[model samples]
Target: SAPVAAAPGDNYVVDDALTGSRTRWFDEARFGMFIHFGPYAVYQGQYGSCRDAEWIKRQCNISWSDYEAKAASFNPASFDANAIVQLAKQAGQKYIVITSKHHDGFAMWPTRVNRWNLRDHAGFSRDLLRELKDAATANGIKLGFYYSIWDWHDPDFVGNFPAYVTKMKAQLQELVTNYDPALLWFDGEWTETNPTNPWSEQNGEDLERFVRTISPQVITNNRIGKRRLVDGDYGTPEQSLAGSPPSAQLQETCLTINNTWGYAAWDASFKSPTQLVRDLATLTSNGANLLLNIGPTPTGTVSAGQSGALTGMGTWMAVNGAAITGAGYTGLVGQPSWGKVTRKGNKLYLIVNSWASTLHLSRRSPFTVTGARVLGSASPVTVRAAGDGYDFLPSGGATNAIATVIEADIATPA
Candidate 1:
């Protein structure tokens, strides 16, 4: 696929956070939710997370006709898409990214290009995608789509590369036209023949160019080569990252609430709310965003535990979201064991990860401490001008493990 070079547009630079466009907006979001659910949840007995190969093998071992049979019994009449979207918003997430299709080749929405979509093959007649889209729009959360490039059922793509690109283009065009997605996450790019492989730079660059051309505001994953996929965009890294996003730009790391991206029945590696909160704080302090994921059940119902965790985090966000959102790195002067740092105007956020009796630290940062207060609990904390630096014991309560907010006046670097 030769790159279809398009005329330049949207002069916004996403390469660095300060002079950025979409990256800045996404980074400002701080915490966004990733939804990965489908008919596969019903097969909890056979399938698991999308991350494991064994689960895939077990499920794929069955013939397509047999798998399609699951659709008949897949009655998620309990699906409350609005409630799920509501949960995301309540969780203080700024965006919602859903899996439109997985490797199983089952489409969540009706597709003109492929009839093997949820509306036709599955017994469910309703439109989950449209429902989710409406729900997200109503809640003020930006919507994005995750369409796996690897379609096991598509003969052109399954174990075949040369023919897959053409099919992909058509499917992508359909998605772009119908859903004005803000982000496009393309995964399942590795080859089964040789697992340790990715597409050539030419193919990758072409695909990335195609996406940029289609949606001027759309951002893409780093799975592709020589683009933002490998580069940091405002420091937000989605999926996985070898390191944090570059400081000049916003960076983010997208990880799952559980070990799996898609709904997995037996996947019990659910992350605690504390862990999630801590991870978000750590990333934000380092000038990054955290794209947390959740997989909805086939009938569009999110698990109770998942919902609870999200709401729990939301409760904390309600009181402390200001520190997490749109704040820059504290530059820490240097790293300290207390935790990480985030700053907004004159306020500096020190997210102490440890639970020590007292915190002892020193720093000569380009900022002046004016005041300090704990989030969730607005009580004054104590700070002292330590020798050649400063020290403080931040306030904490049963509500959260993270420490209090430290107000500081940032001075221009000399």
Candidate 2:
């Protein structure tokens, strides 16, 4: 069937097949880079137990006037767009999403509606988003933008809700026209409710309509309003993967490289590449994408620690990425005690993150194993048919290794 055209000002009805194509693209993309850079990076200050270091104003109870003052000196001279994109490419990421606007109400791009933008207020004068967009395109990576609905610094937000919404729409229009992002990630919709709060369900519907009208092909997340499962193009479960995959809906799990989403100079805790690789397998097996985040330094350099971790993950991804990309949840229920499983067609990927004497499977399956081999190496594994299941026998003693990808060809009962 042909797609019906939307009225001039009405929301476009996305074709079901187009939506599925978008979901399939997202599912196969598998990994992406999430960035949380803004004026907050200038003050990598910490608070006790507050993970969102980016929300420094709210967490520290700083006055809006004082917080806005930081923009005057917010100059990240070392921000290298090409370098960042290259690093993400090396990490085997397919896309990059950065904060275009945060709760601070400062637009990273030049905006006709707001004077408090990168060129005017931050005084950086360079269009950061444009640089990243070009770099991403050159590197064959998709570009996405993150925008916040809650504006603490916008004066009209205090009392005039309609005016604020108008301003938001205008600013978004600039983003759509100037940057042309593939994804629009909205945040800060769960702020305190007031008469002027523009995050009601109906308002969310309207905002999504505005977005679709501007960029018909852009995908949006569920944070437009209350972030209900039905609100947006995909589900965004932050910091953790969903226990069960959503029925026929897209899902992406966003996790920070460290404890905080924004740069925290004092925050030394970081996830090892091995743990992240294992996590990648675990999340992909459940039919989800992992959006790993990194908060760049105040001067806009990717921290050595973060870069090293990404490099390590790149090494692992170079070999084991076949188990992630183009893979989805297996028909089998529940996770294996030894490792996880990702499937594509009749191929089963046994992801082993830990060494075990034996590997187990679900008690019941309708498939018979034909062959098995370890990924990245010619090492062979022994697979034997057990009643209603199978057992994997490893050939070597590489238990201390980061992860092992075992590929198996299984014929499903038709």
Candidate 3:
């Protein structure tokens, strides 16, 4: 698919008021983890023709009573906060955003406003969100919460809409006050099934203002209202990366490790480590962040396949992370056919996706090349002035099986 152009009122405008000092950290963080966990995992995408994970209730036409009953058996006994945090650290992720309350209206934390939560409804004793907060703080990882405005189990959502909003605000207060998350990722605001979602732009603005009053510095996504720039601090491009408004707009691409956001017993289409690394590099090169997702099983353990893929990415990050962390699109050079480019001050990291004997720049660059070398390795690369551009010749073959980065030291004409 082609990239979408930004239109008027598309919310691509950069609002300095909404994006405070925290936006810098978010941009440089580069990579983060997105966890989708709830009672829906119990179903494991088992609905006959629906075959959906998180949206199984609505898609499969499951009765509300039957869907609510899954909560009783939804004890994720093996959910280890420390292990999950450790996995994020191992994957070189700086932050984490877990589903606090999804569309099913099942809250992961024990909310004072309602008993439809992990603790009260599922008969679980431990506070899952609190445990994660502790683990994240101890590990030096920023934590965020994913909340859904749409409620399937709540009666007020369909009966008394304003009452539902009141309850929603109360729940948001509980999450921010208790957990102190660094960000809030909202969803389920789109009017897909319900022609009239009842969640108006005014409602979203009110909620955004209310959130700032509580946690003034916390970050938020565009889904808060109509997926517009004014609704939140940044845009969330889901599943596909082609929907980015423009390079100037702040956006994060949220993608799943496999086909589903929640555990699906038969969905085995997992992206390889090479592809994941390339995707991260490409997104970073485009001045966007990647929030890779993982759907943990009902047992609360990440499958070996998912863990292994993350480990592979971690292995690469351990060596060449400098090329990614804090790097941004420079626009100094056109995107090369063989690879992508990221920059930090005078250094240009040429990320070669498809290895070649001699990588040439698409056009003549203004910055003069001083020196070049393979990132994560001491091997020097030979640079020569070619026709209208420069060519980079590596001493040997690609260093890493995945994308091998060449750090080019450049200087402007003095």
Candidate 4:
């Protein structure tokens, strides 16, 4: 994705806020946790197989009213928002984007606008997001909200989107006003793509002026209207996202830590620590950030499997993230290997996709590397100067071989 420029001035916007500092901060801290939790986990074994998270209730044929009743069962007494954020921090995450309101229209917070939120139905009167926000801030993590604009139960919106743009604006106003969010991640305009897209029609550019007021300084994402909407601070690519670097303009991939974004008891298509590390590295190399996803159980705690994966990723970043953070790629065009690369000052962080005995250095940038080292370990790896670059000879007590960090000062292409 190319850089999306925001209208410069009083309010700077571009896919997401990528100020020199934000960019530097994001580049240094490459991984983040994308959380999605709701009433879906309760039906883990309802059918013959564990349902794909996004469609559990719908597949079970549960009525809207009946599903609402499950809100009381949504008690995640063990749901420790602080623990989750702490896990992300330990996993080397710089930020956490939790879903305050998904398509099901279940508000994680007790909204003044409606009582149909998790507080009323789930018998849990606590403001879930408030706690999350506090925990995230306390842990020094940037906070963001995953709010689906396409509300299935919001009669004003959904299929009646355009007709209710006024009401939709009101809801957005409430969302933006109530919570000072870092990013407003929206989804579900295409039924073929988003499970409940048909529930809400795609109303284009409806919140430009409204959002301008609520938090003009706030960041936004793609999927609003046209590609122009991509002008919101950052470009968000979903599960299709794997390897890509953090662009100067800001780019993020919202991928599930597990195969499914929602919680399903038997869904075990989770990516291994190797695949996860490689993907994170590749995204940095390609110029993007990885928003690893986690679907919390119906009661609110992230599953054990999800927890393990995130912690593993965090462990890797805690050591090797130096290259992934605080840098932009040199746009090494024609490089066959599609992986993420990050750069800061003179340091080039190459995130390898698959472990290789013989590492080939692509000649694109013209800058010569003065040195090389594995990310987490301070011990320098051996790399012989190639024709235009250097050849890295792999050696170490290899932590998951998927994403081995190669640090160097890349030669600037002439």
Which lDDT values do the candidates have, in the order given? Answer: 0.65, 0.80, 0.85, 0.66
Give the per-residue lDDT digits (tens) of candidate 2, residues 89-135.
Answer: 98888999999988888888888897888788867878889999999
Best by lDDT: 3
Ranking 3 against 4 by lDDT, winner: 3
> How do all models score by TM-score?
0.83, 0.91, 0.93, 0.83
Q: In candidate 2, how many clashes are counted? A: 0
Tens-digit lDDT track of model 3 for 122-141 = 88989889999999999999
lDDT of 1 at 170: 73
Model 1 TM-score, all chains together: 0.83
* Superposed Cα deviation of residue 394, candidate 2 (Å): 2.7
In candidate 3, stretches whose alpha carbon ends up further than 4 angstroms from where it belongs are: 1-18, 48-50, 243-246, 363-365
* Model 4 C-alpha lDDT per residue in residues 1-414, reported as the tens digit of each score: 233454453123233332443345554556788888776656553544434565656666677776666656778777887898888888878888877777777777777667767777777867778888889888888877777766677776645555646655666677677767766776644453654444322244445445656775555655554443334456677876544332435678878766677877777767777677777766766667789988887767777788888777767777776766555565552233635456676676767665566566666645666677776666557777665555777676455455666777655545
C-alpha root-mean-square deviation, candidate 4: 4.7
Worst 10 residues of 4 by lDDT: 9-18
lDDT of 1: 0.65
Ranking by lDDT: 3, 2, 4, 1
Report residue 214 deviation for candidate 3 (angstroms).
Answer: 1.2
